[model samples]
Target: MSSNQRKSFFDLSASGQKKRLKAAQDVPLPGSGSQSSSSRREEDVPDSPVPLSQPHPSSEDQALGHCPRSDELELCPSASSSDEYEIEDENNVEDSSEESSNDDDHDDDIGIREKLRNWASQYKITATALTALLHILTSHICFSSLPLDGRTLCRTPRNINTVEVEPGHYSHIGLKSTLIKLMSGVSHTINTVILHISTDGLPLFKSMPGELWPILGSIKNVCSLSKIVFPIGIYFGKKKPIDCCLFLKEFVEESIDVINNGITIEGRKFQVLIQGIICDTPARSYILGTKSHTGYSSCIRCKQEGIYDKGRMTFPSVNAPPRCHEDFLIQRDLDFQVSESLLVKIPGLDLVKNLPLDYMHAVCLGVVKKLLLTWTSGPVNKCKFPSRLVNQLYSFVLCHNLSAYCSILGFPNTI
Candidate 1:
């Protein structure tokens, strides 16, 4: 075994020490004159201090007294007077630290400008190519750009509230306070503001059953070109009637207050009214506290009973009720007595007149989509025209270059 692996006297037990001594008798001792024992002993001793020798100073450095001072050498006892001077020459030219820092900043600015220019050039090239490609594909490709100002980009503070009805169950932001704050902020310029609330069921995924009901509001005073919608509430999961009522409860109370007593903003008071709600048939039915659109007596305008004809509920020609708000307030056969809708509670908001049918859903999705699908590939009985005629019609529509018209119809390039 190597000497390093051998057990020391302190490490050995009483019996182990006797065994070590017997083993040591068998091993030959190192000669007295040999360096083996001296070397081993020297290995155990701490190293002695050595004199530090510095590099020789240049003639110019020596003349300038840049070499280590005598007092410095004296402070280090191990240093000799013959030790070379290691001090640097202070005469060497160099830019100031501040100047160097400024230069680095200038270089960084230049680098950033160059990168931006390159990126802009690439973007321009890409935009030009895309425009040219789109132009070739559709002759009537229209481009509309709206310039945004500080007012347009201004974001109002959001008040998010958590309501704990059950443990770990929290509600989203309170719609009443949020809407009041939003109205108060915009009351300065507008003397009167009309709000149009819209709600629709949005399926979160095509393959999943997850759904979200988002309530949106838009101001009527703003130009149609610059009109922006703000989200008031979002409910996840099944859109139950009770949940809908709960969501609109706060909003209804706030709306009544705003309509009765106008909000003051910057010393000016502005009257705010919830003019109407825009939604599809199903959502409208839910909000109006009426029967589903497919039910027997589903028509919202009239007391017409829909006939179950050809696998569909068809409403026949009937004398509809007067287009008045009070008509809807009068409870119908299917009206929910327990959970009354917010639409009926809020004053000035005409349930019948204010709740206009969304053209995008009623006309575009309901009529146009059905007609298109039928023309393209529906049952022979339902198809509007022959396959050859439908193809010819499609080609004609494509040739006409009606992108703007199609866009207005809510289906661009659908032909």
Candidate 2:
């Protein structure tokens, strides 16, 4: 149906009210001038049975023991109490025809709900946005069958416990369960499923020292800006997790089961693969139980020791000995390995190959942002461009409409 028609349905239902009209009776009142004439007219008119198809009065009307048609009873103030029982008897009988209209109204309600569902899914509306829309419509529109809660409409869980994962920590929803839910009814075969897991520490409050270290994972095939991102686990404390192995205990156990002996989602077994574990330098060091980025043995890819230059550790060697998975598993470098990583328990997962640096963290946000800030705001040097050259470059960007390009590169309106 058209949008206008859908809106009119609500408007008509809210504004239009069914008025109950009753037959006027010639009952005499306390201040009546034509008492004899009313009695004569009542005697002249013969009483007839009320039609079955006529709308019945509600229970409240029957309990009052009188008809409340004020417009018809303008001349006669008093109503006969004898008709009260008769009205009760009429109300007791079922009106099947009246219910047909209600059935049609219910059909219309279902249609409207279906349209709203399709519209929401087509436009990819967020749960919060759709919930707000449903609330607004429920409050203003006069719909008997309209849903008030967004979760009810979306068919999601109502109560999600934050303490369901473990005690003294935050929540952890399993990856295998989430994958089963997402890949329930697929047309094509999904023999292998790839995933990218990431963990990072975020400060919750600035006034206090509350931090959250969440283990987030996403499917490689469906990971996008528009898609829903679900977390594997979250740790909430004043600081980061004290023990990284203990924090990743549940994730490692669950991932091992799925990786070793595949998951059977809806009776279809599918193999799971860890595509990568994307993380920043500090977060990677924390999760992998290695020295921090400033340490001598902080290089994740190679076995080269960092040199302390200008009061900062730096990796100047380009031809360093590359580290392999076997070396990492065996802990060949004592300086590189602080403690054993729980991620090693997962079957068929490479500690080196499956832990790749993400472009956003390692390149765009890290190197490119630092380079731009240094060139634009840092002290003047040979690397910093002169004012005339910077203005020309800015003009060239405006001429080529490269604002979006600059924004994607992690710097907006800056050459």
Index of the highest-lDDT prediction: 2
What is candidate 1's lDDT per residue for 1-415, written digit by digit as tens? 3544544433458787566544543444545345464453333221222225544556555444343322233233323322322222222223466678778877765664455345545566454454454344345322111112211112224554644221122245544455555555342355777788888877777875655666788777756412667776666653333455666665677677877887665576678788788899888877776777778777766666679998888877767554456556666444322236766878777777788877987788888897887777777766657867867877887677567456554334654
lDDT of 2 at 60: 60
Looking at model 2, residue 36 earns an lDDT score of: 82
Candidate 2 lDDT over 66-175, as tens digits, reads 45343322242124534765676676654555687789888898888888887888899888888888888887656646787666786777765565223246667888
> Best candidate, TM-score-wise?
2
What residue pairs are clashing in model 1? Answer: none
Clashing pairs in 2: none
Write down the lDDT that model 1 would get. 0.58
lDDT of each: 0.58, 0.71
What are the runs in model 2 whose C-alpha is more than 4 Å off? 1-142, 147-168, 222-228, 369-381, 403-415
Candidate 2, residue 102: the lDDT equals 80
